[model samples]
Target chain A: MRGHFNYLRPDCVTECLDMLDQYGNETAILAGGTDVMISLRTGVKKPRIILDISRLPETRQVEPYGETVRVGSTLTYSELIDHPVIRQEFPALCAAMGCVGSLQIRNVGTLGGNIANSSPAADSIPPMMLRDAEIIIQKKGSSRIQKLEKLIVGAYSNTLEPNELITGIILTKIKKGYRESYQRIGRRKSLSIARINAAILGRLNDSGVIEDARISVGSVAPSPMRMTNVESHLKGRKPELKTILEASRMIAQEIIDLVGVRHSTEYKQPAIAGLALKCLEDVFLDSSVN
Target chain B: MNLEIDFCLNGSEIRLSIKPWETALDVLRNQSGLTGVKEGCGIGECGACTIIIDGKAVNSCLILAAQLDGRKVETVEGLEVDGKMHFIQQAFLDKGAVQCGFCTPGMLMSAKALLDKVENPSTDKIVEAMTGNLCRCAGYVQILEAVREATCMKAPLNKDDVTNS
Candidate 1:
């Protein structure tokens, strides 16, 4: 942060990729700068070039491709919250984005930035993981798609190369009968970093049995992760209060097993379970289990 | 490295040579001489540096000055025309929303941004819009009242008023 860096704003994707190709390692890709600006000030990230890709036309659109929708990397949270298709189709994702920051932060913060920054407490990740998000990344000549869960490695870390630019996040549309819910435990409602958050997408068959389930939890782990065991347990279950209670406890147990006992484990164990219970009830019971 | 960034500020087209690290908050307060944009928390946590960019309220401190290039920027100064306070400002006075006044400019800009978009915002909408801006004086009740009152008055004529004036 002490040294001076060149500011580069490329209007098109080709130019952006070319710039990244040459000055990848020495450059910091700035999408919203909600996270990067702080790092720049604190000397956490000192790059030779500050690449401003917020205005690239290629990464500023939301286009539908068959059953999936491609959300541009730089599209702000406010834009996603107001989008008709996102609102109607992906209400859980919309709610997660709405819980990000206040209106001001939402107006500028982007989903791509959230994933790239890869904060464990990012609210958007849980809900996006519910839809099975895939990130489209590109450099100069070639591009590759990575699953959202695979991209983020740990807290504030990602596997993305310096030359790689996240172009868009493609998410599958939630089909009929699927009920998705995002629940978070924060210190306060506004501008509070989520202590523990969970997103559950469940579909019940005609006989009131859970046919499919997807559960992703955040803030408790190094990165937001899917509870595959809990999801598998939920499938074909009756989604009754007893089943949900057991599944919620399993979520905490799963985390305890992965992260092992920590200083906050006693508090976070029940907290994460309670959060998962709320999300599960929202998805399965469609009302408060209490 | 310094770069010339062009953007519309408070209805006027201007350009300035800004360093790469300088934020929009820095450019607005230092280069443009608009001290109204306050910086409470340099991070995005506090909304004291809130400003409207391309019709959306954003934390100016979180935005690089170069990001404002080719975008329309609005600050508290834009709310006044010919020394007459905008209706939103008038509502603040009528409702006594200002206490210590450090968070007033940010609050006013957040309110203006909301009123500009939604014709008649509900209480929840106002709360959502102003949640970013923290009034340390605990003047939120009065501020919310002022924004509510502003919604009842002329329906945000400041944009046109600024142009006409």
Candidate 2:
């Protein structure tokens, strides 16, 4: 708030693209300013040109497009939670959004900003990974779609070019009978970052056989990594207490191997296992109960 | 350097020249002459400067005045009518939701925005909406009651009587 900068408001996406194309990284895209302002205050990040692109109407919509649902980058988490299509189709995202800073943070924290900021514990990432979110990056006359996971390279790091702005997040509608659940171990219920978070999306055959599975986790390693080994173990396995426990251990071990055991691992490894087990329980084991 | 922005303030359309360094809280308290929007933490962590922009409740301290251009902004000072306080304000008074009253404005605005869209909100929704607006005294019980009371009164009136009938 104390820093001096030039403010730019572009009415159209094209204009924003032009501004970014022209000014490059000197201009920071201002969405809700929830994260950016905090970063500026702490001297963690600095931008001389603060471009306010939140007014672009086209990037503020939530709609179902063909087989993909397109969400405007500037759309706030609160709006996304209340969005009917998002709530019904991708409730995992809603659950993830619900974990973000309280209701007030949800109102101001933009989905685009969340992805662009690329924080390790970004509440929206794990669920977005469950949805296999595609980030739409655009410039004046160029556009490309990149997987959200790939765009995110490391903690507080992303592949986004300073000159390109994120336009939308496109998620393919999956028809496989997948059950989804999210669990996060945070300090408190509100405004707490996840010490470790897990999201599971999979479907069981009518015969109670695991047909396909996808597991994503956050706040464990550098960025939220997909537990593909765990997924592979469950893809053709039968749904049972033993298999679920094994899969949970597999995820916990995989996390350990990747990031190694940190001081928190004593609690986090078991916590991660428990969380993974709970997700599997909710989706595969406890279907009839709910 | 100054940038001109047009945004609705307290339900009225207004335009002002804003320095890029100024936050919406700065504008609301200084240029706009509405001090109801208080600034507590100056960071997004606290919601003392909460306001309803368009339809969502946001921390005004985190919002740059430049970002509010051409948007509808509602503040706590705007919660009163020609003579009577808004239903949420009245409910807070009746329910004793205010402790020090510093956090009351943000709480009321957050509650108003939530109840405006959802006439009948559950206890969880009330808690969810008010989570960003921190009350040091932890007056959440009374604040929750105030929002519920407003919802209870506003539910029967239907949409016709919502805006000060």
Give the interface RMSD values of the models in order: 1.4, 1.1
Find the candidate with the highest DockQ and give its number. Answer: 2
Model 2 Cα lDDT, one tens digit per residue, A12-121: 99888888988986878888788888877676667888888777998999879888899999998878888989888887788889899878788778899999988888
Local error of candidate 1 at A88, Å? Answer: 1.4
Error of 2 at B93 (Å): 2.1
Query: lDDT of model 2 at residue B163?
Result: 68
Give candidate 2 regions above 4 Å deviation. A288-290, B156-165
Q: Candidate 1, residues A1-290: lDDT per residue as tens digits? A: 44578899998999999999999989998998888888888898888899999989999888988889999999999999899988887988898998988888889889999999999999999999988799999988999999999989899889899888999999999898888999898988989989998899989888888999999999988999999988898898898899999999999999999999999999999999999999888889973232
Q: What is the DockQ of each candidate?
A: 0.75, 0.76
Largest TM-score belongs to which candidate? Answer: 1
What shift in Å separates residue A140 of candidate 1 from its native position after superposition?
1.1
Q: lDDT (0-100) at residue A157 of candidate 2?
A: 92
Give the lDDT of residue A269 in candidate 1: 93
